[model samples]
Target chain A: MPTHNRIDATKVGDVTVVTFTDKKILDEAGIQELGAELFSLIERDNRRSIVLNFDNVDFLSSAALGKLITLDRKVKQAQGRLKMCRIKPEILEVFQVTKLNKVFDIRDEQDEAIAAF
Target chain B: MTEQSDADVWRRVIDLPSERGSNREVTDDLLTQLKVFGWPPSDVFAVHLAVEEAIVNAIVHGNKLDPAKRVHVECEVSADRVLVSITDEGPGFDPARVPDCTAEERLEAPGGRGVMLMKSFMTRIEYNAKGNSVVLEKRRT
Candidate 1:
């Protein structure tokens, strides 16, 4: 996949770890870019395990959450697993409030997330 | 107009075209102004996210992304309070009709979570009678 400014992708064992470069992923443009990039990444990569690292991101809008949902769906369609790790408390609150916590496999650490895959 | 007391709140009202990019511009402007007014980083993030959700709702859901339509944004900032109102030009929907995204059946749904986040972060949230306009407020402790 082509390089993306909003996120960085790296490989750890069988997992493709995607990390957001921005601390705030609330902007519409950035959110759109992230969704497109992640979609492209999932399509191109044949890997079945994906770990989304939220360590750098501090706050994200509902739009960003929507993008994550989209990514989760794409991963599921690819017959792969998706896990989110290192989410801040405030950001986690959003996931909890939306009840996405139940739908997603979220972990307090990256190792745990990657291991789950 | 008469001179106002320092205690009086200052307000800025902006007219925005129903464009996606305007969300970033408005969010940056409001965060910058709030930071200068001595709001902490966390509070700034709360207001920023709340406003982004409101604006996106207005432009995308409310205005249906019609360039011909417009969104009116009003921001009132006082020493200890921040009030923002966003109005869109589309036909309104019933707020109660919005499904509960937190429910198990709706968890994976792609939409309908914006209002939940807005209500979670802001101190108070109110929708106008027409349901096309939403007001969000945060009062500093």
Candidate 2:
């Protein structure tokens, strides 16, 4: 298992449950590193059924959302599933305002997200 | 928008290189002021998000990360409101032409959502005709 500075990825019955290492995902350089770390789960590790737990992330910029969008695309191309759980209400509003809630598989809890897979 | 009252004072005005992280100082000041003035966390989040997006757009999209250019940032924060204006030295593009990121076909696209998020979070946003400058405002709620 590769060590990731930007995220903590653990396995829950073959599903990679990932949580961020940053409270605020705003900086461009940091966001790029985060995106790369996430993409690696699918591109390099070839893991399927991923759930991104956003319990600790209190804030994120639109650029971070872009990376998640690209990651979702990559996971789909790899025939893996990507789900997001535990997004803060304020951060969740960002998703709703952008109408990305419809595009993403968002669940209320990590167990729910994992069960959906 | 042209006239400023006694209360409308710009707290910080900076000319920064068009580098990726150059907006940090101004944004840091704005966020700190908001919190120190007792703005709620949710409101702080909105203001912070809008300001970050506008400055990043100025550096990345408008100035194209040209170090030769600069991003002029003017920010004002008071008890009731926060205002920030950012202008880039690039050949300005048309904000109207930016495709709707929410449109069905473009929903999956990664780019082009910054402007929308800025508009959504800021209480009001105004762009100069040349589109190189943007003013983001948020009122205490």
Candidate 3:
């Protein structure tokens, strides 16, 4: 598959940070890769805290939102936490509409998100 | 292929041939134009999200990321609504088989919510299998 969507993951203390630089996250194949990467990162690090930084993303589809929710569930099962930050207001509204804001701890800035962990 | 004043409400239909690297800029331009029209932030976001999902699906799945195949997108704006249609080159799939996004087990799977989001935000969604197209309508309300 084409690597049109890029994702980078790193560890911040006990927290795992995944940054997506893709212009958009759509399609079945890309979403599968995203879910796999996130799950592996969590399982490998056993981190209770995870931060998804969408500072560079301008759009996110419901499929991508589903992945976030799924990852959140995984984190909880592992006794960890999931947080999201730097979401654009446009993208943030999607979360609000879907009521995902209640599921994930959202912060306004990356620093605040990391601090929340 | 026509130019109008920046302030004019613009509308057109373009063939989204599967020439892919990234069509993000094109999608961005459309959203920007809609934003300029004073589309409420939520509605704007919904339209952008829906368009991106539809276009990306066309580029990736429908056209198999083939630069040779084409996807067609049409946009129309009246005083109260925005209507867009996206058509792809692939054989197409059955919309009936799409699992419900709200289902508990399928909640975390990436990439199954395009139809769901379109249905949720758009006032009307019509799938034309004969044309391999999906039409979306969003009202100003």
Candidate 4:
């Protein structure tokens, strides 16, 4: 229920759908804020299923990817599911190059991610 | 980067404190020059990622965010290509020793992906013998 500067969170049935507000998630301060908000969904609110909608993000650095890796572990430790959707092809290349696409549950659309959970 | 030193193109050299957010101004300036020179968005994105990751490595891993230390960045932009070099004032490590972050066992780790990402995105990436400095280059084709 807190006001988040980096993302928008809403509930879809049992899944909490989060949308990134920034086009570029590069700066360290912004990445830290993003990681904190994401961790809070499971650590503070105990939301079990989460979908990160990336339609708005045009660019994201490795640091942002690092935060996602940590967030994925946090979600898994809490017995929750995490999925990411709507990644731009160029941005998706980053995941593929890093082989993180294999690690994350990435779908082509938002509804697919929501339904998967 | 020296190849374009005498050519007519957008160029800049900056020295900044080793800390968070210091790369933004230089990065923004480079992005603008690339845009004006007609580098497509996708190509621009690649340069952006490569540059951001390299500078951050210089500031965080190389300089350790030491206020006494400084990170130097040199950039050049042209219609044909863009080149960037980042150097940090700290005892350097070997780039060859950075573990492959994409390895199966290390996939879950949060860090160590920057170097690999830089290589994948940039056309060519080279580290100094001391590893305290890196040069990232991309040629538009």
Q: What TM-scores do the predictions have?
A: 0.89, 0.94, 0.70, 0.95
Give the lDDT ranking, best first: 4, 2, 1, 3
True A-B contacts kept by model 4? 0.86
Model 2 alpha-carbon miss at residue A42, Å: 1.1
> Of 3 and 4, which scores higher on lDDT?
4
lDDT of 4 by residue, A37-101 (tens): 99999999999899999999999998899899999999999999999999999999999999999
Candidate closest to the true structure, highest lDDT: 4
Question: Which tens-of-lDDT digit does each residue in A13-68 have in candidate 2?
Answer: 98999999999998878999999999999989999899999999999998899999
lDDT of 2 by residue, B2-110 (tens): 2232544437778989988877776787788888677898899998888888888889888999889999988787788888889999888888899999999999888
**TM-score for chain B considered on its own, for each of the candidates:** 0.89, 0.91, 0.85, 0.93
Q: What tens digits encode model 3's per-residue C-alpha lDDT throughout A1-117?
A: 123235776777767677896766765567778887787766765667788899888766766787787788888898888888889887776766555676678999888898886
Model 4 chain B poorest ten-residue lDDT run: B1-10
Give the alpha-carbon lDDT of every model.
Answer: 0.84, 0.88, 0.73, 0.91
- The full ranking of all candidates by DockQ, starting with the best, is 4, 2, 1, 3
Clashes of each: 0, 0, 4, 0
The DockQ of predicted model 2 stands at: 0.83
Could you give candidate 1's per-residue lDDT for residues B12-126 as a string of tens digits? 7778888887766656767777876788877887788789888888999999989999999888877689999999998987888889988878887788888888888899999
Q: Give the backbone clash total of model 1.
A: 0
Error of 2 at A40 (Å): 1.4
